[model samples]
Target: MRKLIGCGLVVALAGMLACGVGTEDGPGLQLAFARQPLDAPCPELPGEPGSAPVLDAVELTLLRADGTVHFRKRVSPGSDGKVRVGGIAAGEDLTLEVRGLVSGQVAWYGSAAPVNIRQGVDTTVGIFLAAVGDVSCAARPLQAPRAFLAAAGLPGGRVLLAGGVDRLQADGCGPGCDAWQATAAVDMYDPATGIIYPVARLHTPRALASATLMPDGRVLVVGGVRQLGLQAGSGMFLQVAPGDVLASFEVYLPGPDVWIEKTMPQGMVLHSASLLPDGRVLLAGGGTAPDEEHASNFAYLYDPGLGSAGEVVKVTSAMATRRLGHAAVVTAAGKVLLIGGAIYPTAPPLEEFTPSAEGGVFLEKLSSGLPANLMFAGAAIIPLRPDEVFVAGGRVYDGQVLQPPVTGNSRLIRRISSDDAEWQEGPALASPRWLAGMVTAGRELVLAGGFGDEQLTPSREIEVFDPQGELAAAGQTSVERAGHAAVPLVGGQVLLAGGLGPQDVLRSAELFTPAALAGESEQ
Candidate 1:
């Protein structure tokens, strides 16, 4: 009987060891996670006067039943909206404490509610901030001729930024039009320092113009109005030059400071221009006729290598509906996907443009059952996965001329070309806005500055959406803005160019990193 008891005890001990129970009876918590963004900072909304305190540093601790710590970590805000904590135990209760948070200047911070963990569970903690009075300089005024360094480039080659509006209004930048003027200055930003230096000035005044980075390394500056007024109808209209939409285009080469004029096969305005993988340039649909030309189905293809001798070829008129103020992006499949923009008054509007084998073909490719509500200035299209296109955050078409601008929780992320042939809502932004800049960086979708009709105010807030279509990370920009340009650079960073603010055209720019999305997970 004693021998049988001994054998049973040995078997039980073996079973416990296999189950990861140490003989010493130490804590059973095990830590594991995918990646951690240690340097990325999460942005906090600016505190109001005497409002509350803001937390600067967050510390996370894993504890046992006896209050003994298994692990601990410290985190801070990164340029991108991420605060990652990697290597968390697979199953352990965690307590988070926020310290060094600045409430005005006083280091007033708080702790978060305790979090319970389960095996293979991923979790997050929220830390609230208190506000105090702020005395530092507000966000700098964003101006024209804005430039950012390009990380990806050919060897021995340099990137340059030219032909944006100049700072004509210096009424102390930050929400509210003080002064506005056209810009003619050209500059270049060094990737090493993130600083822009004066290069040479251009003789042209181009505002709201489209600039394409050509394969030959020169920038192709296309049609933009050179005007001096705030009203939509009053400025000198460049689109109607010489009694027709301006057919004139120019290219700026760096060897020497020069702007060489080139003739467009067709004069057009507000069109979408992109560089094909073959080094050819495709200029598609815009207000092509003359003054106030709405949407045109016409498209033109330009080959720079063919030089002045080559004729600009006209592609087929294939759009089901005319469109403008829309976004056109080159998909990973080498096809151009034109997302939500204003459609003409014609029936069955809203279409997509894809390059056909013959030339270019614009066809209606969205699901009929999907929401066809008119989404104008607010729509942004980005790729979620290689085979999937994600469309999110835009105003719905009210079927009337946009007056007083559209507003609110209209947050919806639709998935295209997935297993489902339709759009499924993902997540919404903190606020509803129009004309905000959208781009994907580090497998995350970022929504930046835009205008909200309710406040009629521009926001510098920036938010990051996860790859899994989950909650958005907390972060914001130094300025609120929209109508600005957000382009992806090679090194996985984005260059936010000129956009209109409430008061003035933004002359300033900011860089965003993806550090705030950092986290730990259980295996």
Candidate 2:
């Protein structure tokens, strides 16, 4: 393989000592390459040699942006005898050319798939240099997790992760037991460095509840259980245990890093909440009581400007059925779009709420076209346009288990458009882990670690989906644990913070880079 240097105008091939292509022992290697992003140009261009016989002397050439040969040279393969390109500067997108002579014949020779060289330390493009007959391509690997997380943010900023569950149900125990630790701590990460700093600790515990970041930058942490058990002394060994599925919520101001306890509609677990465009928080459909086997469709709106300021006002009746572990998102039209949660009956109905206090009317009920499973863990919503809500992975709606299984069926990102609507299946995830956290950055959907079955085996894998006309793999993340939180930063990257791992709970975080958009051309 030859490396291209300079502004795509110059190339130098590392010398090979063998005369003919290598023996037929190994298949010829295929070459591939990717241009550097606009902001970060690679200092060098890396090319690949497809599965082919070993060759002797190879020459690399470059076509300058000015249509002139910038430089050409013969390079001795430093270690592997493969040609190397280096010393590229910023602002240069170079087209590389490679040529190799084998068996007294000029065999491997070809140009690259275009390199986007930017101003950066590591800009890699894999170009294959191979003879036609002996060359073959390599298999593609799974997308990286960090690349997915970084693309979840817009150009302006990233998302903010307040605080979430640190451990799965089986923490510090022998095995097969699930529990949640009620801590008042909340943290946010700096997207640039993936560093997490304590934002504030709540006066009380808010675990496994819903959390939303308001437009004003303040975070709202709502209803979660502080204590464990069923019916306050049923003595039943439920996996989760008897706990306070809190009905009350609190506000955490990022600037002040303070927690303000506020009134709530009613205590519930695994409920859904969204911030309406009007600035009021609309919470709906968790469990009315932790001990109850079923959920109440009862919905409420907390008027932050209302009596006592931000009081939870129960206004509506219940939905067609009760739901927990369902998904909800506020549409661009200011309607609360809810869908795909498990009810007590363990059936499927994706519904939405228009937030009417009078008769408790929702836009419509959606139940028809779901992917045969629903989970209550946590779900991320991506708005395709303004009106469409795309619900990604979550727990399968199971009424039998006290805690819905930590696993999720490989369901496509479900879509809920209007109230009187049917659930539509969108692109499915690369993997099917549940309790995973998701956030959006521009055209990419970022998914972070979550549990597979038990929360202890926290998956650190990060998957990003590019929603540009077609959904595709953007990149992968470095972490492998689950039950963590991911938020977009003010910059282009996203910050991922604490979650559960197999050995112990995590307090660390990482950053994701969405280089796909940054590297590709606009048109």
lDDT of 2 by residue, 427-455 (tens): 66555566576677545666666655433
Model 2 quality (TM-score): 0.60
Q: Report how far off residue 248 is in candidate 1 (Å).
A: 2.4
Best by lDDT: 2
Instruction: Give per-residue CA lDDT, model 1, range 1-523, as digits (tens).
Output: 1110000000000122334433422222221111111111211122122212123544445555455665565655434323444444444444433333333222322222244554334343333221111101111222243321111222122335555444554432223323344566655533222334566665555555566776666677665544322223111111233233446666776667567766666665567677677766677766622223455767777667666423357887655656555556565556665555445433343455556545767666554434434343433344355545455455443344433333333334344443233544545557666556667754666767766653446666666656565546346654555656665433234545545555655565445544422223211
lDDT, candidates in the order shown: 0.46, 0.47
Model 2 stretches with alpha carbons more than 4 Å out: 1-175, 178-180, 191-194, 227-238, 241-243, 288-294, 307-309, 344-348, 356-360, 363-373, 377-384, 398-420, 424-428, 454-456, 468-475, 520-523
* Clash numbers, per candidate: 38, 87
